[model samples]
Target chain A: MMGDNEEILQQAADWRALGKGVALATVVSTWGSSPRPVGAKLALEQEGAFIGSVSGGCVEGAVIEEGLKAIADGKPRLLSFGVSNDRAWEVGLACGGKIQVFVERVE
Target chain B: MKLGFLQKALAASREGRPAVLATNLTNGLQTFIEATETAGDLTLDAAALQAIRKAVTEDRNATIETADGPVFIEVFNPRLRCVIVGAVHIAQPLARMAALTGYLVTVVDPRTAFASDARFPDVVLSTDWPDEAMEKLKPNRRTAVVTLTHDPKLDDPALSVALRSDAFYIGALGSKKTHAARCKRLQALGFNEEELARIHGPVGLDIGAISPAEIAIAIMAQITQVLRAEPQSDREAA
Candidate 1:
């Protein structure tokens, strides 16, 4: 079987080949005891189909929302989540760690 | 994040080529960096490229601050490999355990009766002589070589080849006295003390393992320690 990251990229490429909008989100950096390490990936298609993850489910919903926006706008975005941010609490990043995610459209 | 770059990254992963994907945060520009080639539009300076190469070699991913901006470098390295130079009973469990730990494993033995497919399911079996098999394997820094056969005719040639290669771990199974005699013979073959010292004879951590299965466990544990522990000096100090 292919590794998780390889599967994610392969899925994203397959989605793009099918003419579906695809976006890839990566855990670019982390601070404290982040659940996922840097280089973890989450690939999302326009209709909300997803593969892999950048967090331990706490921030994946928010990341998928941002990924959809990136797919729509053709603009890449860097998102940060931490206990210090109020949105982090709303998104349930209750692990007391911080993570930066880079979301980009797979053109 | 171009499709071409993604395809290239997939190819590198499948081909077991070490590579790095550097994505610039400022402009969303990206580049795929391999040892001999690169792709994408992002232009990296000498320092940044050097850092990327370092990360690839160390099998690490990091976000680096460069003059252009913050670039996230994601490294992809090939899987580790373990080559067992015997198809003995101990090799069965060791091969399974090593495979579970994510090492690509190969078992080598010239005896067709012992290295049969029924004995080793889902494993790459080599019915070639130890020296010929070791030559074909060409053990590298990511490889671990272990000689389970106590026969010097088989194990000696494999050990000699392993010592000459960059394999991160080299082990031989035998009693202490047997290992001493083996060392003496290898020394006669011109392997100096330093080179021969690299062989972990008596082959496992000094656990009082009696059964073949238990011995396999002990050997696996020692291999894990050598692979994951700090550098030799720090470990010796500890």
Candidate 2:
């Protein structure tokens, strides 16, 4: 299929098969005016490489950081990010929304 | 990330079967659930398995809570399919539009003159009889069947098979009188009123579509509406 879901999962599977550490970040839930809907995915590798997007460009850098850490620790983490007034401009979540992303190492 | 499970799930995706991959967020334990399985103990309790099955059926991903922990149920639904049982002028635009909407489109007709690969570029062309071709295609719930040929020989057989299958949308191109006659013929062949209700006879929304392209657009819009809206039977019950 042309959708990004299969492609992202296939990428993680391929990276895992190649013995490269991989972490998957999925937008499990969203609130208010999130950029991407729930079930959006962002995949990351051990070397800070990534494909797909969970929040378009708003929180990718932070997600990438969490993804790399998840790959290192092997413990899954649920990350929450929102467009708060103080950090809204800094994180670029101008959509005025919040999202919960579940990041886990692809075992 | 069991290689065997991943491989099987990939194969399922390729083969157009709905599958669910339930992964334990706490421990990374994973297992695959086929469509036919009754949510049995596949590393998940009954409730979580039901949720996964529901997500797979709805073609969406869901997170389920269970005794173990939160499990992310990743749903791998097959691509939506549009099986057009004619290769007329309308079929041209219809096939293209269906493809643009992310549907794997197939145009079937025995007429070599119209069902040419040149006419329907980038669409699966089946030059077999409509019934035989559809049998091979195996229209599922994710499939929408549309019959454009006015000939009963072509359209009826396709509709017969499509009505028997799990195709979500079945539309036949004809006028009100033509559709009434077609319904009578189908009723003579033993189809009941409720089953016949599934077919959108004067196919497409009442858009006053004149040209073949416009008619195709109307049909596509109706298909999309039916797909996104609640099921007619469900809505009626509600």
Candidate 3:
């Protein structure tokens, strides 16, 4: 665990060891002014529980709900945010930052 | 389910096992790397190091087959760390410098007076023998070992172990004349010329350092040079 996604992998391992269905979300790329770093992680549990962080604070709730669905369905997803002006404001994204988040099921 | 790869890499690193991180930065996929773990009590050889390095550089993350997968590795360097074996006047500044350079530094010595918390305020002070204390420090690809005690009893055994480990930098603080005599003794004890050559004696760069702080700066510079595997001349000027 020495790369950008090292912490994500570590968090995934910790969650899995707890007998939980965990989904790992990574901020693969980002543009403009964003609160979270590029490699920020978000872990969503099967019951809609969550740990770690992706964005600063914007869209976490929506992301968590989406993540819970992914875990319940046992499917992976790629989520995008803040590309357009209206899309950015809906999620409270500042400076119109665009980020691609990859959500993969880790069981 | 198959998380052993990540776990083992971190565990090996936490336990001071010498491991390298290989990152593959390319388009489409994310980071790509194929890091290898050195398993066993036996120290890894230079060939093994080269093999892992080759794996890191050759891991073209530009693209992968649909079945093969995307980027596989990212980042080659580990958490920067260093174990200073000897709590001397110079050790104090060296430990502090190492910490600032992102090294989790540990200063070891049998003398409590020298290895006191007051002297090494920023360092993890260990009053154990040099050899025993390094176990906690756990040298790795990201770790360096420096002998500043200038005591044979401490450095002799410590060097034996440090040289055999995967520490990327091994330096000893002593004058050239003192090291010449020390080298003779080490050779008598079975250390070959090649093994003895690894040590960077007179421990530091060409900087004309007279004070303890300056010496620390020079030594750290030497270490950075070693860690990056780049010639000192090629390093970007600060």
Candidate 4:
């Protein structure tokens, strides 16, 4: 199905349920090649799977890894990817590009 | 039915749930839209985007009315997120713009000095190695990645990571020369031509932007464009 519409429906329900807190992550900028567009989203919970994205498969582990700290700190964040080949393979990046992820905890 | 999908999807996405709505935009759009229901809260109150939800009948192939704006449901998938790959000047404006659009924004950088709270007062600033950083910041269908730094080292590697995932939008910043050079390098690194097409280099819309703020607007415009996947007919009407 449509990616955003699915995400939107879930977001509305989450809001309706009055989830503890909502955090918004955005892909503000990029270099080289990449997946997701800027302004893409991935919402997180206190402790569970998340919605949205910042990079391809390569950088998600890093994002979720960081999301944990973000929820604990209740602050927002800015993340980055790099232009290295070894790293891409490590995270399964198909293209050689860099990305920046901005995470904000919606108060 | 127009408001049905949009309203329902918005509600679901906010709840950390998932709902798929369909619209006619890209290829295979009809098949996908039909997969999900055109449903939403009966008392939905999206006044601004409301005009876009009218339907001729709940019939399939019914045209989406986007004369007012883009016609795509903001699906209720998971958490709303955005991944910023660089901590540059243009990114500063971009991060703010993303937040305004209701995305959860995270900025990443390896240089602690460049990625300090002082630089980005309101965001989650990380000073970790980018390669290692992306490992934890993996993206899904709802994810988006933008590489702001133009350096091949920073930008290229990050893109490699993004390309391997299902992120919705992937973009890079550079001129024709820079992009050409980048393509050459990527081609040499076992990248197929088709995979490269997913990238939006010379990042941002061609809005004749000059300043960081203007460029930020262009970038946001492009991002919104990809996220909505608005149909050409809707644009013509607008």
Candidate 5:
């Protein structure tokens, strides 16, 4: 099997070549007992297709929502999720950790 | 996050070269950093570039605080490789364990009887002579070379090539006396004292290992220790 990062990036490139909008989300930083390490990635297509991961299914839904926005606006976003934030609870990131994800459109 | 930079990073990974993608959070600008070149829209100052280069050499991903903002530097290093110069009993287990640990393992031996598919089910086997195989492999900083033939004709030539390469680890299977004799022979061929010291003769951590499989475990542990040791700059500063 191909490495996860390579596979995700390759898929993103393929999607872009097909005239589909794609956004890439990367975990830039983490604190406490984070589920995924820093530099983990999650790629999303405009049609709601996604690959790779930035968390243990705790914050991916929120990240994908932000990724979709990025794809639509062609603007990058930095999202912070932590137990201290009410949004984190809403997003179910109650794993006693915090993560910062950078979402950007694949230009 | 430009497509061009992503493709460049992918190409570098495919070629087994180290690379880094530095993203400026403030402006969404990015730069791709390779060993001898830099590309992309983001221009970095000397200090930032120096920090990125250090991160690349150390194989670390970091978010550095720059005046512009937090720039996340994602390092992409080549996968580790293990080149076994013999297909002995120890090699069988060693190869399997190395592959399990994510190493691209290759076993080199001219003796088809020893390097047969039955002996190494899923491992890459090279039937070339020891020296020739070493020449083709060209072991580098991400590679470990181990000679286990216990035959001077096969192991010695391979050791000669491995010693001259940039391989991170070099090991030879032998006892103290045998290693001493081997060192003498290598010295006669113009290897310096420091170069000879690079080889882990008697090849494994001293765990009192007795069986071939146990010895393989010890060697694998030793290799991991070497691989995860302090980065060069930290070791030098210490």
Candidate 6:
């Protein structure tokens, strides 16, 4: 009954119901050469289990780390990544774009 | 147990209904709107309600500004459908092609032999009369209807039903002379020129197609054209 994104969100809920903590990261907005469009999502579980993508391999690892943190703290976090900074190259935003992702624990 | 707005939206989506879900980002309050049904128990301010209706019509997803701040609107539309009125040679390929392109294809014909499972392997088959079949199908804006049955009793009834409905596209297979005769007959039935014009007789683009497969290709191309192009621009191009 769910669309692609909703399906992933449902998975998050299902996993949480099974006693695994889960966090959802959603692309709230993006600018200039961002690989994933806005509303793209990624869900991560407490045990390093994850599904879906927020970005094309560029920032998923960092987002997953943030997702895990969100699952632990039970608070939402807004993350911003851009290629303008020197550390962007190491984090995979080499496409000269900026993206704002909102990470929240799914209850 | 009561369902939340998200669960209600999911149920409506699975049923292929036109639905919109609007969420106030700050407060997380949600409004679920089913375009075809009554507003039911949900209540919202005029601005939010108007925005949701607009999003449903446009099939657009967006962030809307309301008195209560920004609301994220997600729109859900049913999958596209193609109802072919004849299980003829051209329809064989047409059904396969439409299915390949993500359409839920249904082949309708009263002739049981032609509408057999062997002919339309994966397609939905209806062996009822055209009018009865069409009534059951209930062609809507998301549906495209093509009549390959040359017989007036068969094709005419289906064409009339489609023309009256909001079906996005209506096509009929025939030659120019045959089309002229068919149009004249419909005009006798009190259909005005504008209504009659909706029928794309001698269906499909002018692609110089001859074989059944080629004709099916042309028909699918024309249906896609009508779907994506503006009516005025399509007329100009035609």
Best by TM-score: 1
Clashing pairs for predicted structure model 1, backbone only: none
Candidate 5 lDDT over residue span A3-51, tens digit each: 3577788899999999999999998887777777777888999998999
lDDT of each: 0.88, 0.82, 0.66, 0.63, 0.88, 0.78
Docking class of 5: acceptable
Tell me each candidate's TM-score. 0.80, 0.77, 0.55, 0.50, 0.75, 0.68
Error of 1 at B192 (Å): 2.1
lDDT of 3 by residue, B120-202 (tens): 77578888887777765667666689998888999987887787788889999899999998899889989899999989998
Total backbone clashes of candidate 6, pairs 3 or more residues apart or in separate chains: 0
Off by over 4 Å in 1: A1-23, A34-36, A42-74, A85-97, B205-217, B231-238
On TM-score, the stronger of 2 and 3 is 2
Cα deviation of B9, candidate 5, in Å: 1.0
| Top candidate by DockQ | 1
Q: Which of candidates 4 and 6 reaches a greater TM-score? A: 6
Give per-residue CA lDDT, model 2, range B1-238, as digits (tens). 4555656666777688777777776666777777665332347767876787688666766677788887878777787899999899999999998987868889999999999988977788999999999999999888999999999999999999998999999999999999999999999999999999999989999998999989999999999898866643332332
State the DockQ of every prediction: 0.37, 0.29, 0.12, 0.04, 0.30, 0.15
lDDT of 5 by residue, B109-216 (tens): 999999999999999999999999999999998899999999999999999999999999999999999999999999999999999999998999999999999999
> What's the i-RMS of each model?
5.1, 5.0, 7.3, 14.3, 5.2, 7.4
Q: Model 4 chain B: which ten-residue window has the lowest total lDDT?
A: B55-64
**lDDT tens digits by residue: candidate 1, B55-160:** 8777778789998899999887766789999999999999998987778899999999889999999999999999999999999888899999889999999999
RMSD of 1: 4.3
Indicate the worst ten consecutive residues by lDDT in candidate 1 chain B. B229-238
Name the lDDT of candidate 2. 0.82
Q: What residue runs in model 5 are displaced by over 4 Å at the alpha carbon?
A: A1-8, A11-23, A30-38, A42-74, A81-99, B34-39, B89-100, B116-124, B174-194, B205-218, B231-238
When only the first chain is scored, the TM-scores of the models are 0.95, 0.90, 0.77, 0.74, 0.94, 0.90
The TM-score of candidate 3 is 0.55
CAPRI category for model 2: acceptable
User: What is the CAPRI rating of model 6's predicted complex?
Assistant: incorrect
